[model samples]
Target: RKPGFTLGAGILPFTHADYIGEVRESGLSYLSAIKNATQYRQISDDITLNAYAAYIFGLIDLAFPDGRPVGFWFNQIKQALYLIDSGLDPQIIANVIEVQMLKEYGVEPNWRGCVIDGRADLPLDFSESYGGLLCQNHWDKDPHRLHASPRAIFYLRRFSTLDLNKVERINVKLDTKAELRRILDVIYTDMVGVTPKAKRFLDQMHQWQDRLPDDSE
Candidate 1:
């Protein structure tokens, strides 16, 4: 009944090939080559949205900010593929790549989530362990305020019990605050964080505690 809308919708699948072919045929153009090389299927919905956003927001040009023409966008694509080739989860690798692309291109992603209960997957034990490690390393004197540092300690603890050698290997690879944060965020959001209602109740308790006056006899 709705032939016009239906026709366009039906043609949507064909547009994939058209886009791929356009970039592939224009091999001489760096932008086109990057686009072609970065084209990926079988990505998760979230990753697909992120990649589409990057492409639309002039990621190719953004990668060359300061007029340096460094081809960092291509480099990110290469790195992501390398990780995938090395058996990393495609969605995780895609998220990492998207984050790197945003940073390189000077785009700040608007992160949204509940402050306390948002990350239930983050194991409390792991957070404590990571927090201890952070303290030992002098990364931060106070782990309570440093979100992921404590979580890194937790990772170290769990990995230590499972495979100490692999723990060391992974630790070596994780050299940045951003990487640490990402790992903790995933764990917290998926497994360790609490529910929103629990978080709210906790917050209310804290507020009640704050209102109480100190009594030193």
Candidate 2:
């Protein structure tokens, strides 16, 4: 999500029902609640992954307000909604969205090779401060560089270029998902400098989900 946009939930009263009707016809409306003099209504479509839909909508609201033109992001946003609607893992979908957000800001981390020496064969570490990967030879530059494993790096590269519509479901390991989350968190902090409330809530939700007992057990 973009910096400087703070998101929260509340009701906005629209005294005029006609205005709400126009807003819905613009093809830019998200799920919202409506209340009129006569009745109350919740305006929402049938969503498969309800929690994921909420989280994704929250993230969008955190960045873009009403009537904001998401020019370049239109397609990506649609793709994310489609993927999540089809029941893709929310964590990976979140990762993909975050990566694309970084690209939109032109600050996405470099994963191609070592930022300094361009040595693809060497072990690489992701550096949020430098905004790229750093090889062991240059690890001295940032003492806090992520001791990134090859698998983490591989997925980062993959997500960086992922086309949500073209891909099928990818079941990422828990450990890999954690690593990716950590890496993205650091980069988002360093670059965007704001932790969205929606993202924080999403993280908390994941933690609670992790504590649940598996049915197979």
Candidate 3:
């Protein structure tokens, strides 16, 4: 919904093209392409938004191979971008998207219930190695299970099923956010085995935000 030229990339026909070491801007301008794509209506070039966009793109790279689409996640990705643009809590949005990506990649944690007993009522901890939540009865399954608090598990389950379009804003405690971050880190490292460079950049940006002086002061 903004007017101005912005940086973007799109799938284009390159079948009959040859002269290429690195395609230049002149070539891009010469190609006939559609303008004012509806998908980009809500997107803007602000740095914070761009950071989240990059992170989302990085996740997409990890989730799918080049030149392919995963139909299941198409709308989920749209929802994430919209939520990112809507100024919701970005950490929570990232966490939600990561969980969805895990589901798409077939390693999603057992947020619905304990992996062993299927008891959804009991207190649970996250098991990175065992690949799901473990109640006290089955904690022995993974010697290094993550001790997730009830609050953390609650939000994890909620975020896993969250409808981003319905949320305007959210308030997450710093401790809860930290727990979510740590848990996702272990899950991604253990199961996915790759970290996107954009995630590292986003982490540094978050650290910078944390170190900044309070504006209220």
Measured against the true structure, the TM-scores of the candidates, in listed sequence, are: 0.29, 0.70, 0.77
lDDT of 2 by residue, 1-217 (tens): 3453222122322112212223565467553443333111121233224445555555566567777877867667666766665667867887888876775455767768888888878778888778888887899999988888888988887887888878788799989999998888878777766566657666777788789999889
Q: Cα lDDT of model 1 overall?
A: 0.37
lDDT of 3 by residue, 1-217 (tens): 2344232333221111222234354555333443433443334556666677768778888778865767867677777777766677767888888887787677877788888889888788888876788888888888888888989988888888887778878899988998899888888888878788878887788789889998889
lDDT of 1 by residue, 1-217 (tens): 3554423422332122222213233356222211222233332234433333333233334345454655645445544444443444433343344334443534332222122333433433223333222323332434443344444444433432242112112223434434553553454344333222222333355457657896862
Candidate of highest lDDT: 3
**What lDDT score is found at residue 109 in candidate 3?**
76
State model 2's lDDT. 0.68
Higher-scoring candidate on TM-score, 1 or 2 = 2
Q: Give stretches of model 3 more than 4 Å off.
A: 1-31, 38-45, 213-217
Those runs of model 2 whose alpha carbons end farther than 4 Å from true positions after fitting are: 1-48, 58-68, 213-217
Candidates 2 and 3: which is better by TM-score?
3
Worst 10 residues of 2 by lDDT: 7-16
* Error in Å for residue 10 of model 1: 21
Put the candidates in lDDT order, highest first.
3, 2, 1
Candidate 1's TM-score reads 0.29
